[model samples]
Target chain A: MQQRTILSTIEGHAAADPARVFCRFQTGAGTEAIGYADLLRRAEGFAGAFAAAGIGRQDTVIVILQHRPELLYGFFGAMRLGAVPAFMPFPSPKQDHALFWSSHRKLLALTGIRFILTYRAIAAGIDEHFTGLDVRVLYVEDILEGLAAGTVPPAPPAPAIAPEDVAFLQHSSGTTGLKKGVMLSHAAVLRQIDRYAGVLGFGPGDVVVSWLPLYHDMGLISCLMMTAVTGAELVCMDAFEWVRRPTMLLDAIEQHRGTFAYLPNFAFLHIARAARPGQRWDLGSLRALVNCSEPCKPQSFDAFLAAFGDCGIGRGTLQVCYAMAENVFAVSQTTPGQPVASLDLDVEALESEARIVPAAPGRDSRQVLSCGRPLPGAEVRILDGAGGDAAPDLAGQIAIRTDCLFTGYNHLPELTAEKLVDGWYRTGDLGFLHAGELYVLGRQDDLMIVYGRNYYAHNIEEVVTACDGIAPGRVVAFAVESRQMGTREAVVLLEPDGTREAAELRRAVKARVFDVLGLTLQHVEVVPRNSLVKSTAGKISRDQNRRRYMEERAGNG
Target chain B: MADEESFREVAQAIGETLMVDPATITRATTADDVNGWDSVTHSMLVMEIERRLGIQLPMDKVFDLADVGELVDLVAAARSAG
Candidate 1:
């Protein structure tokens, strides 16, 4: 028997269990069921269309479709022909069309991407504003219609693929120009599924319900690939729809008897707040609501349980997983039936001394949630400031070595070399180990997580500094803890150049940030020049400015 | 209150939640007209309206609301039904 890739595994499952439901995709109208056989056939139809349009093996195909069935088909179809497929987010309605399309020029040029699978409206937008790139835009509507009318030729035979071949690319979360494509191999993905699913006891008969976007690793690998490779069922809905009406998840879990779900900390809060008081549903089918992608805050889980405890949610039902795209998904996951561990540390000691000391009497304490133990083939180390492994219970930069680590960051050799050193990937997260479990203590880098998405503070700063009336190099962006919201909120402080009114400059900065990065800054403060603090390196210090901002806010309050 | 009054209240709630000018909002105002009025703030707006009006809007219908006018109508319908 040969080592199986994701394509081969899915094909095998389709042949063995043709009638099994692989995906129950819910649109705004209703749910559409696609069985294993149907999925394979539809994916092959897309493959045929791509073949007719000159997309061949190793060609990078960027799928920019909305959260529709074609998104799934286009992704797998490219893989079927041994072509590389990477999912990019469709431009939001609020985003500027010209900026969104133009931002992809560098990425497409670097990767030599010639084919973009998208819908009609996006294709028209690309044709009008996106220039200087000779790229072919293949519309999903036309292709599907052509396949139905028998106008397109049949798909060629499946190309031979090794397990080590690149399967797909997961673009990291950031502004468009700064996004790094993390290339994952077929073998690594399959290996991660085996280890991760084994830990969660996931297999056939388990329905994984999700409303996460397919562009990210948590959605692509955990829910989509895991179900496909393991022959389990997936109940998916559009992420935007879920955000507006979160109770749809409850209804789906009840209707489908869904056993598992992956959610970020903020979603737990969103759903809890959205549910009607005293209303109940039969959510007893859920075994684990795994908190992932964002930091696992115990308070968020508590709020969720307070809302749905009568619906069979409990402390044990809430698990936590520390995951990232570079690891191909899960580095550690709590056992399904076990309560997540937590530690209350003295805030002063932990913040000032970089030590994980237990809270003393009458001291301010911070409750840190445990990310459970590492998976079977993963190792975790805490690197001290001097680059050596730190002692247990000391907070430092986290590093991990996993069997499912990504091949490299596509087209960025320097970054790949800097991050991956001697088989250990230096994750910029700060954490400590206690009793064989990892306790994450925020980030060492300026990356912030808001509403389950990662945004670099430096990216926000860059966007802010480019706006008019802002002093260049006098802007700093950072995240502040928002306990009421159950997630971090981004704050930006910039010194103005006296060219525009403060209120006008503030509004312009907000609009520019929203238009560029699709993120709404929680607060923007325009101050006089020289108001910002600088580091010893003579650069605007984000950390020092953040501390000053917090102090000023507290003083005023 | 009449539909006009209800519409004013809806716009007020939207402005407060999204930090926009309430006077700028109108019956035909959709999410596209306001910056920072994406999915997350939409939910926040729903909750804010529910809190301010002391009524529970139907979750299914709230998700499909097209404009501020639809929201105003939904709140009225829920109030009458309640």
Candidate 2:
């Protein structure tokens, strides 16, 4: 196979299908569709405008727009000029302004972003914070207006972007409150896109419907990059739209006959709950629903299938895949029409002994669904505490070496060196391979040690969320060191909808945690929904939550 | 019934759903008046009201329902038409 650069592939697709719809955006005005020819013209215009703005090869530019077609234009425009584009998470007022500003400053410092392209709305919201910064800001609409006026200078000759050249940077979810930017090379990105397209059987005829935030890896690389490379029509929506009216996603998918879509586990749960009676949409066109960015819950898959079975969605259409920004996106994807493989293991034994013991069907066991075998050109290994390869059933840290491995953290050699050990990237995810299939337990950092037993926080959260009155997929469980026990104790933070009594809810949470994980929780804090902090990448910030808890405890003391 | 009666019903529902005092909801009252009328809570309000009244409100109208009076009128129209 002749490997081509992302830009070359996109140009080829544009040449082949200049009249085919490439991207669609919906706004208050109405829906707008841009064909491949229009997409290329806009991208070129963006490139020209960026060049006019003094951006050149190796320069970093930050894009801070919501899910709009202009975001894609800005992203590809930067890449077309060989400038590295970093997608920064949109600022949220709910976050601590000081911390958010500091984090943004740190990211800007790390990337050395000299220019930012954003929508006027977002720019206005955060303009105060950018004051005095050396970076220049350009509104996307203004840039488009300049392009339309033909006032923007023509782009310089396309620089020869090598396969190894840094293409873009994606930040980790900062679940531990420390954000690390993953620098993906053009080759790494293209390799993953090829793997993704092949695994999902996507082609130019396919259309991808995505509501995931463009800043996230799953959204930026999988949905945007894959579509750009394959010339697949993409229907993009903001995360707010997806959350507010999940049915709208179904409607758009049906209206566009979208063949491919991607979502996190929470989205499936939300859609399942929100799918009302008498609401129907023809979703038979959807061939694949790539579930990633979070742990794939079998229950969510079951619920989604049951809720929209009439929409032509079936069990085989739900895919469990796993990847990280470091891998440039997908590492493993389930094959179509394959029975969803879920491993029923004894949770007690798995936690206590670090051994995965299979249980018979119909038995009460913790079933961890397989995310499938690694894609071609990717190698995965489970290493024990001593860094030696673990046996098939022994739980250990996941490490991978792939052609799609990112080019280390941007400008952070110390962090890069720590994450990239030997020849493999330490994923910081705890899992074990059984019969060549990978089952990701949880993040190694998120493991809660209680009474000398290891408990995955995600599993605990899943169990807690199953309890009545608790908000599904909104709980955070972590281990805090107990002063009396002189050991880490399980502390579950339940973000309820505020309709339940605190005392009774706490009791129920404690009992549920105890019953599910066999570990007694030391404390349960029922915080408000959205109060439990999460990083831009949508991972729970356990360290930040723990620090906040400690601060609150100190204030009370 | 007049708009005021419809307003009371919607205001009471919003108060119950959001766990705020119904008296606090008024024509000029915004989500800021309630303890937890954030975006997620706002969606919950829309979803609950839609479920109760069996009406599908437009996305903009849902976000535009800033006060109890507007919410009542929207719900009343949605109900009366059905």
Candidate 3:
């Protein structure tokens, strides 16, 4: 069978299982189900509506909706009509009105998006924030109504498009600065899905559940697109609802017999802590729990397994994967049903010589799990500072040339040129190839340089997390430009339990970090637990933390 | 007197729970008034408030409370209504 675009796959499914449930959404109002046929019809209506609204081939349409089925319809419908859809995160409650307005304006300006499809609730919110953005807003309900009324005209002729034509624009996490639109073609997305699905052995029998926002690559491609292609049922929830009642997510999985799920490390921790005792549900149907999008700590894995072990989750079911938006969704996923393992290396040797050395007993070691080998058709290489490939077992910047690689960053040729060198995408992550497997250490931008030594913020965080009173994996370590030293110094921000005194927590963090990295911590800020900034996908926002720190210092001064 | 004591107790509890100095606790204080208040901390605050007061505060109110005064007022209203 020849491969097809995501839209064709959905249309085929609709033809085969017109009455079968494709997507389900449960809200306070009630539960709603959209069958395959209904989904296809709605998507066709959306495409017709877009055509009526003067949105044609190559035009960009912004989609801002919660985890409703309408998001999928709008996305596929726009893309099927050869229009590029840019998924933007709904405004966070923490964002001030001014900030939200400015962000919305900036996104509009960047994407040149004139047509926006969003829920009525969000449209009102945005209107209240900014008066005249000159963008045409269409309520989701109106589009659905038009579809129901059969007012939408017949589909226009399909635009001429190649396999490499840009399908949709995925924005980066915007942790570093302004978000960049990652240009992914239809073929690239399908290739990525095939790689992941092939590796995990996912099929029609699988049911994938996710609460990650649609704006994120992991959420869109892994949960929605992959499920559609594999004919797997999808269960999705809003992020806020998940955070508020995490047990509800588990209930959905058990109730729906969901077999596959993925969450970032922090969410794993949150769910483990939030799940109340004696609230029993049968999770025996769950076959895979892939943790990715951030570093998967052993502690989080253990906690989740222990919490759900009575309900049939086992050790081998916990797999860790590595992924980013640039390479589509996943680069490497631990083979399903494999026992998780880590490579324990001497911290000093790994940092100084860029080699993984076995740790002696009762000594400090950096344990980074092997993300497994690259997916088939994907080539992984570790490049030195000069872009030459590093030798095996040597750490350097990780790069990959894959059929699944994105086209480039949308409209940023210079930045795209810098990252995509001779068909190899520089991932900006420092890692090594050991015995043909990839082990990611940390991002090059997040590396802290202090006193002629290189220390990764994540490594420092791991050290501090070993302390009992401090919340594990909640530490944010960064390098602040020190005026006295004329270089960057390490500043560790920890969210400690209320019982720990500031001085004690600071001392403990400094001692542990220094002991592990052989470098003194310049500053330690002990804030309330859960104070760290995180991207929508729940990865720690280091640049945001640095900006907040600078803003605080400026305010204090 | 009872209301004031209850208010003070809630304020102190929030201060201690959030690791803010008790001296910094005030009726007009809010999450934004504090140095390191973010959404995660805000969630913690909501959880702590519920635990300390034995009240199930609405999620909207938990997110909408801009100051200590608003929190106290909401708590008081809930208490009186109950």
Candidate 4:
């Protein structure tokens, strides 16, 4: 095989099979099939628009468009000029526009982004917050409306790109909160796609139906990059629309004979709940629906199976993948057409001692689903608190050394050094190796995964502390598992600065958190000034406060 | 359905989903006025309203509701359309 960059590989595919459909984009209007050649040509038009604005190989462009054809074209167009492109979420209708755009000032400053490709309305929104920031905003309408069919302005000469050069940056956060740009090189991304696609038996005939946002790794790497690399077909819908109409995924799968999909555990529950009774689809065409991103819950899979078993879901249909953006995508994935393994462990031993012990019959046990074996070039290590290897089946911080490991965090060299030690990247996730497979526990840090998005405890605490009637440094934020919802819900506890109505205080905290962070706090309680627990270091301990909160709730019940 | 009847039904659904007092839910009540009425709960509340009113509201119009009054009007409109 000839060595190729991502752009060359896609361009090669387009040259070889110009008429092959690459993507079927679905929206409120209708589905539009874009062939390989048409997709690339449109991308080149975007490249021309970028080049006319003096954007080239060295500049970084941030794409802030919604889930539309232009989002895809603008992303690839920037890459077409050998420039690094990053996808960012647009402001949701629920979010305040000024707050949303202001939140990205740090990101814009840190990434040195010189160009932002967005729509006119969003460009107007960004202009208010980003004045004097040395950034240029390019509107899609202005760029595309000027170019008629067969009259695209010629792009400048393509820059020669090496495989090891930074291809793009994938940010973990969406519109608000913490943002870390995990930079992946072209070689690393292509290598990851090759291995991951091989494990899933993916081919050009396979059709991926997804509603995942392109900013996330699961969508960017797995759905978009894989299809672009393997010349497979993709059926995609707007993620926001899918959230409101969860059944659209099923409809697309059945209509397109879709072979695969990747979803977080919460989506399985969301779709199942939205489906009315006796409503079903012919889902026999699907080869797998891999649960990923968040901690894969056995109960979520069970709920999905119970809901759709008669509609062609089988025991081997639901799979699991333990993945992160640092590895480009999948670290471990369950085999296709095989039932995922499960273990019943002693809940007390696992939670209290951090040891994996098989449960005795008729005892309290936690059912854990295996995120099968690692991809060919990836190695998993369990590290104890002492930074040494932990014994097998014992919980520790999960570390991985992989051929496709990320280059580093984009511009934070210190953060890169702190996370990637030697040749191994220490994932702040806690998990264990059992029977040659990975069983992921929850996060070891103060990070919480809600609906597969990461938010730090201190971030939420900071928002609450800034609100009225809340004491500074007196708010503690944590997550509680909701089995019914198949996800984690954030809970906030705070001590008030004065005597305020409890309802008013709670309402204020929730509203402020939503306004500032674009997330809802499930529970907000105002406690006494000194009621929160502290660690030995005199810092507020999220773990202890979470345990105390759970105990009090149990007692109340 | 009468406008008053629709308001009461919508308030009941929102109250049940958010665990708030139904009496306190007024036409002016927005998501910011009640705790736990975030986007996710908003979808669940819409479904509950659909179940109660026996009318399927369009998904596009269901989002971006300004207040409980808007939601009640949406439900009443859906009932007539169906």
For DockQ, the strongest prediction is: 4
Stretches > 4 Å off in candidate 1: A128-130, B1-38, B51-82
Q: Whole-model Cα lDDT per candidate? A: 0.87, 0.75, 0.74, 0.87
Order of all candidates by lDDT, from best down to worst? 1, 4, 2, 3
True contacts kept of each: 0.23, 0.07, 0.00, 0.43
- For all candidates listed, what's the TM-score of chain B alone? 0.92, 0.78, 0.79, 0.94
How far out, in Å, is residue A240 in model 2? Answer: 1.3
State the lDDT at A45 in candidate 4.
Answer: 91
Cα lDDT tens digits, model 2, A1-557, are 43478888888877876778878887546689987777777788899999988999988888877656787788888998999988866654333333344446545655566688876654444556656667777888888788778788888888988888999888654421245668899888888888878877888889899877777777787788888888888888777776688777888899999888887775776676677787788999988887776666787787788889778878888888888889988878887767678888987778787888986666558878889989988899999998999977789999999888888887789888988887699988889887888888866777654422346777677768888887767787777654322235567777777678876787676655544343456567778777888877887787778888878967975
Output the lDDT of residue A152, model 2. Answer: 88
Please tell me which model should have the higher lDDT, number 2 or number 3: 2
**TM-scores, in order shown?**
0.93, 0.77, 0.78, 0.95
TM-score (chain B) of candidate 1: 0.92
Give me the runs in candidate 2 sitting further than 4 Å from their true place.
A1-3, A92-103, A120-133, A175-178, A360-364, A447-557, B1-45, B64-82
lDDT of 2: 0.75
Q: Tell how far residue A235 is off in model 3, in angstroms.
A: 0.6
Best-to-worst ranking by DockQ:
4, 1, 2, 3
Report how far residue A423 has shifted in candidate 3, in Å. 1.6
Which residue pairs overlap in candidate 1's backbone?
none
Alpha carbon RMSD to native, model 3: 10.4
Which candidate do you rate higher for TM-score, 2 or 4? 4
